[model samples]
Target: MAECPVIEADELEKRLGNSIIVDCRYSLSDPEYGLRAYLSGHIPGAHFLDLEKDLSGPKGRHGGRHPLPPPEQFREVIERIGGTESSEYVAYDDDLTGASRFWFLCRYFGIRNVRVLNGGWEKWVREGRPVSTEVPSARRGHFQPHPAAGMVVDINWVRRMGRGYVLVDSRQRERYLGVHEAIDPKAGHIPGAVNIPYTAVTSGRGTLRPKEELEGVYRGLGGRPVVYCGSGVTACVNVLAMKLVGLDPLLYSGSWSDWVSYEDSPVATGEE
Candidate 1:
């Protein structure tokens, strides 16, 4: 059987000492909130990774709000976090959003042995697992980045192949429907894209639904669907969910943010 990409809090607790645990808690509304939360308490030995600083690159006119950083820079960040290529990485967040992003980034860069903490930090705290505020010392790591192709699709690729693939919008129903948009300039989703809010893949407790359930949810979407969201962050949740059910979906990293940047591109409002 294939290795599971999601690890429970108890499973993670046992592997904490050997694996490189990453605390990916973050707030889109308050960028510093994640760091504050991490400083207050985190899984011992886990390093904090910032979404804007560590995961994304500078926002250009076309690359959307949070473009991925250069591959070399990402590798450097991994090494700084004391992660070697061979290190078993386990990432988590209060919600699964940030944790999924970390998992996707590592996988997109071809780093295996990385998993997301199933049920996330809330479950850990609920279980009365140990937490710490002290930061860990940096250790030299030998992580050589080897980015894998086909895992991600840029804006150009989305425009070109979107018609041929099932373009899935992983944003909330409201966002997908253009009911309300708080961050981006425009509302609505890409033309012809179907909405499948990432939350549907998770249970009421915020943990992923069973594989059989996920398979049922993704049924008839066709194989190798392409997924995206407001920017490219929460979309990882959908991508991760698809992986949990043995499906490999491509990520439209630029997502709606990039799609709207082009004045000529079409946008659809309301349910399709």
Candidate 2:
């Protein structure tokens, strides 16, 4: 079995100096929130990754709000952060949702040694762990993109979905139901998609819930799960959950935003 990418606070603290800890904190509402918060203070020695600038790519018409960055540009980011094939990395934010995005992107780009901080920044601060206003510079390192195959699928793939595909919407129930739309223009999910709000994967304290609990939420879903959210961001939370529990799932990289972009695409509302 592959090792889970989620790490607890205590383990992360001990590995601080030995790891490339990335602060992936962001707020969808206020785009500037992440950098502002980072400037105030963050985990000692942690580098900041803006959800929009660093993690996501230049958005075009069809790709969602947060498209994957161009491969060469992303390679530059990795090298700039002193990441190499051998570097151990940790990403943390207010909760797993934010950090999980970094975890997913790194692994997809072939940086397999990264982990998301379980319980994330909230847990770290609540436990009285150290914080720092000073930033540490890292020595440059070499890296190359080895994009993983079949990890992502585009909108056309979703349109021609088979009965065997288990499409999952990672937004909240209301958003999934089309009862309360906010970010995306559409108010429903991909036809036949099921609701599994990413929050279900985390505990009240913001850490992942027990393994068995996760299994119950995802096991025997009966097909390959292709998860998406309003855009392609929070869906990573569900992707991280499924992978953590030994399940293989694909990400609909453009997600609902791309889905709704096509004038003729189908949308399903209410239960299921």
TM-scores, one per candidate: 0.96, 0.97
lDDT of 2 by residue, 47-102 (tens): 98888888899998889888988888788888888999778889989967668888
Query: Which residue pairs clash in candidate 1?
Result: none
lDDT of candidate 1 over 202-242, digit per residue (tens): 99545998889999999988646899998899999999999
lDDT of the candidates, in the order given: 0.87, 0.87
Off by over 4 Å in 1: 162-164
Q: Over all chains combined, what TM-score does candidate 1 have?
A: 0.96
Candidate 2 lDDT score relative to the true structure: 0.87
